[model samples]
Target chain A: MSTSRLARGRAGTSWPRSELPEFSPRELVDEINAGVEQGLRVVAYFGAAEGSDIRLFLVLADDAQSEIAIGTARVEGKAFPSIAEACPQVQLFEREIVEQWELEAIGHPWSKPVRRGRSLLGAAPSASGSSPHLPAVTDFYRVEGAEVHEVGVGPVHASVIEPGHFRFQCHGETVFHLEIALGYQHRGIERALATGPDRRSLHYAETAAGDTTIGHATAYCEVVEALAGARVPARGAVLRGIMLELERLANHVGDLGALAGDVGFLPTASYCGRIRGDYLNLTAELCGSRFGRGFIRPGGCGFDVEATLREQLVERLERAFVDTRSAVELLWGSSSVMERFEATGVVPKQIAKDLGLKGPAARASGLTRDARHDHPSGIYRFHQIPVSSADTGDVFARAYVRWLEIQRSVAFLRDQLATLPDGAVRSTVGPLPEDALAVTLVEGWRGEICHVALTDPQGHFARYKIVDPSFHNWSAVAWTLRGGQISDFPLCNKSFNLSYCGHDL
Target chain B: MLDLFLARLHQKHRTLAFPGGPPPVLPERYRGLPVINEGRCEEGCTACAEACPTEAVLLSPRLGIDLGRCLFCSDCVEACPTDALSFGGDFRQAARNRDDLVVDEERAIRLATALDKKSRRLFGRSLKLRQVSAGGCNGCESDVNVLSTLVWDIGRFGINIVASPRHADGLIITGPVTENMRLALEKTYAAVAPPKIVIAVGACAISGGPFVGHPEAHDGAGSVVPVDLYVPGCPPHPLTILDGLLRLLGRIEEEPGKRAR
Candidate 1:
């Protein structure tokens, strides 16, 4: 039995690598499973290869206590007992570890490569037949029956969206299972980030999931700032919060519009498409880029808001929110939209809990999980956005929860921007402390975005693991499609709007 | 239904008057083409080149920049000690050839030329393109998708993004062309009928933008297929994308003195 207590940590903070509790592979599995049974959720579980062995790291979040427990287990061989069977949250993480390292998760059910075949640490094992391992080429769960058939959608979809493949096991119009195969968009971001926080690292974080650029970049910056022990100015912290909420407003509005489009409701659909750009334009108005690139950095914000620009931003934000309110108000007025939305895609609260879904998705399922509320950091500590939730766990609930958040975020931005803090926006960040591990969690529009960085002795990145919200909720998306109408796939998908690149990365 | 009509009316006709009217006024902070003041540079200073994440800045024979690889980030402009390079709002950043993507102090970007007369006749009035995001971060994909919204209303120009490659007259490719998506992109390109063209949108599709030099990525679309036009920007603005499409279709002429600021 491992008696050493796990190294306690707070989100968006750094701890020395030497301080982590060490456990055997079996002890690690048992400890994590016991924690999961006691209501802790797994935030990140990854491996960093050391010679022939692997150093497995785990980050478990206790939302009730606002604490994170990090521990490492040394796996001497290629095989370790799977924790996925007991704690379903690490199911994908275990599979990824197995693929990235050559370590096998013994007794893990349905182990498969998460991304296109290649080991993150070194060269992949050569296959028996000719040709190397192909991405999205794997055994899919099959339903055998006379009437059961399969329909496959592309790595190149009809719409102008990121590439991913989807296989639906169908019995005529009813879907038995939906397995999403991604990694067509893998750009080797994690591998590139290892060994340095070079100039290109921020760009990688900014584009990790381009739509969640602010969310991911803030997480990246927070982790770096934590590692270097840098404190951002009050003004910069407020600006980051404003940008994050604006991002939320943009995506939530866009999703509302997209949901309308999927339901064939044209008014809200058309209005939202432009309104989404309007919110994005506000970010563009602050920073040069519409996506908020080059805005957030390690020390603080790259740009600042003057009194004049602040007034202009306030005016534009007011107008955009008004338009957004009018446009979104129509979605609820129409019975046709409501009927289509109310019961379309339902994920039970228990299932959502078991899956460890985050952000609005979990909130829609009656789970009161929000990083801002649970693990408050930076400006979020000073200002609080009340967690908005819905109990239905359907398309309507998801959409409604977004609407609630939209209103809340608009209010928050209005209040925060008016009481702008006067201070220098940026500070010089010192060199990172040698041999540190930092974890950051952000409440992105889709869900929780977790970024874990482990530095070597020289303070360069040894392993940079990014766990996008889509990684957790993609399974929920699949669950939503179970016994669902195949035609409703597009509608259900719009309801969640999970990112393929975020998951694939 | 009345409420829907009222909401529609409230949303109003928000489309931009571009190419027909004055070019839309972009915000001041918008970073378009980089203007290099060659005189301001120190004798052997390579600050701009060193600051660029994608090696877009070339300091050899004076300062030249590769727009195809530029993310339009503030890094270079901020890093310049002599104030040599500043981003000017000149949104016409599409080029007909890959070589034209690299611009120096003296010359502006060679805006994309129209398709040859025959191909122009084929796709001028009705160019249906199928967009494939090979390894896009969704920035390019989302911006391209914005073109079809009421604000841009790209279909008003008789262009649309069709649902199938078979029905498309061309392919608008975005991304760094990851190895996994290369085969699928090729198959989609082949599915299009003859006389089809390929347009690479954003820096990623043109020159791998931020993901440059990654082993999994093929750098750009040109490696897998020929690119007829290169639209520059990390994710080129909707106007930038629209400008490229119209330029290639010969719908809009390249006005010498007109620049959007």
Candidate 2:
């Protein structure tokens, strides 16, 4: 038999559409499953409608080889055999494809609408039915017993958080299963991007997950640059690296603080919260927006750091890091906090691997996988930050991994800012190539953010698929809840700190 | 516990004396209230209007920019051939009326006034708000959350983001108000007791920001519930959101033309 017909490319590079080899639908599913079985990972598996036919595109990352393999398959009818039964990571992608195109994935264990009941190609169902299809109003996995009562949480949450429904099957205080139904925050961003890179495309990317503005923005810009064949200046790349690390610092510190807060450890929680703002203030000082919106553009960075501002940022960053160290160290000292964090919401290594988790969640489970390390792009191609990992897959492991990352990110930022290169911070990017496909992988603070863009003959986007790290990690959140105390949900949730809007988008 | 105490002491009291002595000193790069020099606009120049992603800039009758729709990205300011538009450091940008968000070169924004005396008496001393992020990116949600941190210490003002809508006097909303969240948002507002005020935060919650004209979103919160105050930004700075909240409670007087320290 012949080997899988997959064309290979590096992250943040573009290839002609003709270069992608096409296979029969069954052959393509077999090839993807075969690749996953041999230790390859699925980056993006989505369907795009071309003319009257629905085409399925698969992007698999060979992390060990540091190369991405792309292939396409055309579905003849409304259904295709499920590859998710062999490769679990493509489960969500398959569901999303089903939701968007109304295609069926036969033999898939769980078949349900991934987003709201509103189809991508059709309007929402009218409310005339006895039980109308709506966002997050679906049947959940039930644990049937006299004592197996279910708890249905909100699309309207308790805190100032994004909307999502969380249903838990509980026996006394222990949870048997957790089913998360998201899609409340969806604004049809993907559908809106088909004719984009116009004016609002970059804005959509920046707000893909508001907390991950820099991450998604960088991914989007890299995709544009790849299609346009624009090379970002060295200085621009370094500045982005600084901003990205700064973003990571802010979020990780905030997560630690939130984790502490969830465990009722007030000292670390109070300090880390204030210190997190300090990090965000540094980003605001560089770019006008606290979230770094409008700072990252297609060709390069929107803002440049001058010598004086660089010095000021360095000073503030140092001050914030010092405060952060003091605050985060308090968590380890308080045995009560440690006791709560250890062995709670433990997602074992095998489960994390099976689920293809990314970022610190996977790292905490001893996966040792980071896109920056595995598939380096932009500044990461030159200045490499070491992957921070922990062996124990518990809440403590997650927090410890973040702390480790915080230390490394601070050091990385300090070094990058000190050696700030001198050049133009931005360059003009021209029109994208006609009939091309581009994929860019960015190691966002949360995890790997993958953006795949397929351009039409007019150089406009034909299909744009954004695979947020949350899209992969949300299922892990469910796995963490299995056989754990129901009350530890908040702590487990804060430890992952997945983006709801990112997933919804 | 000894170590915890020592760490807490080392952290020190970091709260700012905002709305008391002076406002926080924002960075020089911080884009606040946009300034439009309509005189600098050349005849038939549509650069600023076309450059805007949300069509926030209106160039027909007069050169006006809508803060509700603006992303504070300065794309229009940069696109202006003659520098007709710029953002000043004055961060007081929130307003009560929807039309007040549209600022021309002539008149400034009509800032949000305090609630009626009876409503103020009901919520001023103690205000509990339920935050509903209709379709918000976490940007607005995070910034609003920043108020409760020690630096902001919103609790000092007797304001809290309560858990239940039943306990809330109002709803603090973010997002472009997507269709999926419309029912929940309406139900949330309905669940709150009568005489409830809804403060829409962020450009998304105010005018749908960049997501404007997208069929999936309802433009903003006003399309559903009547918003009492509009806090504007891509995600308004924590100060911007707090200022809007304070103004509604009659805690802080409007400091017109006052730039940040």
Candidate 3:
């Protein structure tokens, strides 16, 4: 395994063909375990279907080295050894493999369904002609005792948000354990993307986790562009960079406002809410859609940012940030708000690192990991946004980290727009390269959105694995609830604001 | 508290003065309805249709777009050789029926036909909806949630999204209902108090926008439950969603409706 060398690539660069580090299931598990011991985090571990075999791929992201290592193993039997039992971060990935391929992860601690529903595997179906069992029907981890009681919420929640079931094993107000059951929003996006760099491929990527449209879309376009060997023009890259940062500002500000709203802070909540819309509308000003749909195309962006449009974006960006600054500042100044936000949902640094949390959630937990800063690509490779982190690892830390990011993203957008580059907005992307695996990671507002596309012989996608930051952070949310008051669930949940579709997909 | 008041005072008014005052001002670049110029489309020009990811455009049969199926990406507009298809500045893209969501050259989008005499009378004054995101990507969910924000303030119309289905008069469903969610969606429908309406938000909820034929998903909310209103955008603008809800309640007069800020 030590002799098996691994090379690193930027976020969008393509690998014509990756030689997987040779290892059997057991050996591969041991290698990953060794990598973890050396501070290498698992970025993505997905099962790719090959000619009659499920080739499992694992990406080890070494933050210290600023490099990514790839490894793979072909499943030899119905049951593969579970790496999750040793490496906690690979737990969700292993579960996803079982659910998708119907193969057994023999020693997985709890081998319940991950987003359980229809099996995407080509393997022969069981006698029932349905999924082995219903989603969330499997036994949840129980805290059996006299005082322990269970509370189940959603698949359909009280508010206007995506669906996911949350079961809290509580002894009085404190949560003993919280088991999250999602897949109520699963639309089989992975299955849809198979054999597709088709028209719908970009569309599916854009809508995969909705709020992170720009993030997922950018990653998707990067993968496609890399496969096609297309390079976006300077102007186009700048515009994409602007849009990405604007998306960050909009979401980070919105999250801050929502965090305020959760705590019943009215003034800041009202103003920040409107200001968030102002940011969204600014996105509307750039490209037709607010959520930045149809913006980042395969070769480049679909729309161009003309001179007048640039001015409008700048004006709105400045005004909105000013308003947002004042409104959000109130949260920090107010003692009551700070009290609610601080120490409510504390995600310890160790737990965050163990769970492989990415984005602001990880940053707040003092992990100091960001895809933009860590795995630079496109404009990020040239100009960088300093990683924001907090030592608190609490609700306030999360909110404050967002506020920090909001300012930095604003500054980045301003800087990019001020020095507008020259060239066509879009480049002509050719057909994807045959039999290649393109892995891209874009820092979505939520966190690292990793997209791995393995093309079949004809250049169509054979297996597309999307690892939303939510997939990594959801378990961390459960961890945050440990010994915390159950009433603080909504506030804590909003603090993380993990995407359900991103996870469910 | 005084400082907070001062900050808000300086922030000025952000809410739109619409319907009663004037329609909400969408950005110039904002895409809305597909304004089809039949004359501009040259014969045998299937460029727009070919370019459309979801096949929202049909040139050979007719020059029209199925808004329900549209990702609203404006790719067709960009792809069209002529001015046959263009994304206009109309935020009112929601419709009452599946068929109505289809906009041909005529550009007619059917509004929610004012419920019924009894139903309208019951819900018109005040409507409470329980949003069920069956398989939502959360793009629509984000916009839907925006309606409750200060900018949209859907509460002004006496409309509120309550916590419980029992308290809800209608269910606002998003996402293309996945197979796993089908049972939960049905269960949600069953739980909602009778005389309830189901408003499908976003193209996903109306027609499974992107994941239409995916095996794990039943295309849109219509497959699992009857949809009363169809708001069609990849994720409809907050204004569009508000307009659909208002039209369902028969609140909008001519222009986009307004609230007394």
Candidate 4:
């Protein structure tokens, strides 16, 4: 597998000079198959092109090794073979493609139209028929059983979360099958980008999935940098890595607390909430915004740490680490919390792999596919940050993986602080290149965030596609929720915590 | 069982005591309240006025700021590279009347100076705060989340972000004040029960961010109400936000000179 040749090309820094490897739809598919044959797993595939013809980009990865590739193809004349038949992970992306670009995926078992009645692509549906841009009725799945009813749970939930619908097929208290309906929150972010200025487009990209701002922005910048042939300075790279890890730590803390709360572990939840809030306050102290916004820009960061402030930050983090460790230990020792988390919503290893799961979801299943290590960007390449994984893809494993990651992030932050560099914080990024096509990927707290940027003739953004990790993982969530008791749904859902707005966009 | 007790004992109550002592101020560099630098004014340069997307700045014969209309986007500050405009740490800008919010250039400068002095005096101090999303895009909320994580570690400074407004000494509001969230915003303020400060984080909260002037937009947090400190940016940097919060707490001594420089 190490020597296997899929498609070899040198990774370039910028766009106009970057070689554009134009391949026919069939050739692209063949290349994808070649990569898959060589042990590369297809993580996600999304459609992004103007007019009738839809372009598909496949994100391929390997868990045991660090090799990532983005391959492109055009689905011609309406009929595209379903990868879901071979890789169950493609099902959601295929459904999303059908919903967004109105592409038809043939021979997919569960190829249901997930997001119906919402398409802002064009005008209202004509009197003649439903909009061709919208998914057809045939695209929806039909479940049959006596006295088995389907309960639709959203477009909106009671929580502070974004909108998404959960279709549960329940027989008594047991959930036999689950289907998710999303896209209600689709703000046409990608389409909106195509019409906006390329330089200022990163703002919208940062907000594509609000929580994953840094991740999305990092990915967007990476794509731009690659297409533009710009090199992010070493200091900037380190700062970016620090910011990414900070983002990861903050999210993990918040999610962990929320997960504990989902299981009625109020104390743990409250502690975690308080800890999470403190973490955010620290971010504000360090960078200025609670979310680390504006900290990251195109080529580098917008601000740098002062010597005294950096030392203060380091000491503060150390104190926080000690406190969090003790709190976690207490939570673990609690029988009530352990009982609720363990063995609930278990995702088997085979199922996890077949679904092409990534991030904590895949890591819990023993697939230690971390973007920080796998496709190392910034200072991550230099640092030996450990990847947390477990074979048991259960709620406990998810929580444990997050806990472990938080510790690792703490260590990473310490290393960054110890070797704080004194240099310019930001570097100038030149104008974007015209007729540029590039892909950038970053590992968000949830999973890999991929962005594909296409510049127009006037060097403005022609099309920008963001493939959030939630887009791929939501299906896995539904699959995991199946066969579990209905009461455990919230715990299972909380374990994954897929972003509705992230996926919908 | 023993571990739980020990952990609880070892865990210093991270919540800051506010209203009990002088409010914990902010750091010198913290970005918080807005102050106009009268010295940098080009004797009638309307750059800030022109760049004010929301027309928050009224630089007629007398320079005055309608705090009700001022989003605190800091565009006026950024547009003023001469450093005439700055963020004041004194984020207690709440009032009943629109007229109360209106501050002449001299008062604006003075308020800005007072905040600067107070923040510097209370550096590394703690404050109890409440966060409200007054029709925000959730971006600011996410950033706020990052502020508490291990990397930033805002808790070490004794800052506690409470959930309930009544328990808070200050309010961190992020949003463009969507029509639907208007009541919630007001209720949050009312619930805080006064002697409370308000920190507007993000362009949306400060100046409706990008949603300003949109027919779809519902005036903005500032338009519907008043703000104490305003940290500007589409979403201001987490550090800038921290500075605003710190200033409100009176942890750090503030410098009005920075605003004008």
Per-model TM-score versus the true fold: 0.98, 0.98, 0.96, 0.77
What is each candidate's fraction of native interface contacts (fnat)? 0.85, 0.92, 0.91, 0.12
TM-score of chain A of 3: 0.96
Model 1: what TM-score? 0.98
* Tens-digit lDDT string for candidate 3 (B89-206): 8888777789888778766776555677798789988999998888888888888888888767788789998998999998999888887777778888999889889999988889
Q: What order do you get sorting by lDDT, best first?
A: 2, 1, 3, 4
Residues A163-280 of candidate 2 have per-residue lDDT tens digits of 8889999999999999999888888889888998888899999999999999999999999999999999999999999999989999999999999999888888889889989989
Question: For model 3, what TM-score is found for chain B?
Answer: 0.93
> What is the DockQ (computed on Cα atoms) for candidate 3?
0.72
lDDT of 1 by residue, A1-505 (tens): 3343778778988899888889988888887887777788999999996667799999999898888989899987788889687677789999999988877999898788887745776774542212235456788999999999999998888899888888999999999999988878888888888867998999999999999999999999999999999999999999999999999999999999999999999889999999999999999988888999888988889999999999999999999998999999998998999999998889999999899898888999999999999998889998999999999999999999999999999999999999999998888899888889999988989878899999988888989999999999988888999999999999898899999889877
Candidate that would win on DockQ = 2
**Candidate with the larger TM-score of 3 and 4:** 3
Candidate 3 clashing pairs, residues 3+ apart or interchain:
B19-B256
Candidate 2: RMSD to truth: 2.0
All candidates: CA RMSD (Å): 2.1, 2.0, 2.2, 8.2
- Per-residue lDDT tens digits for candidate 3, residues A17-116, read 5544546777778768888888888888878777777878878887766677877788888778986766789999888889888789988998888887
DockQ value of candidate 2: 0.73
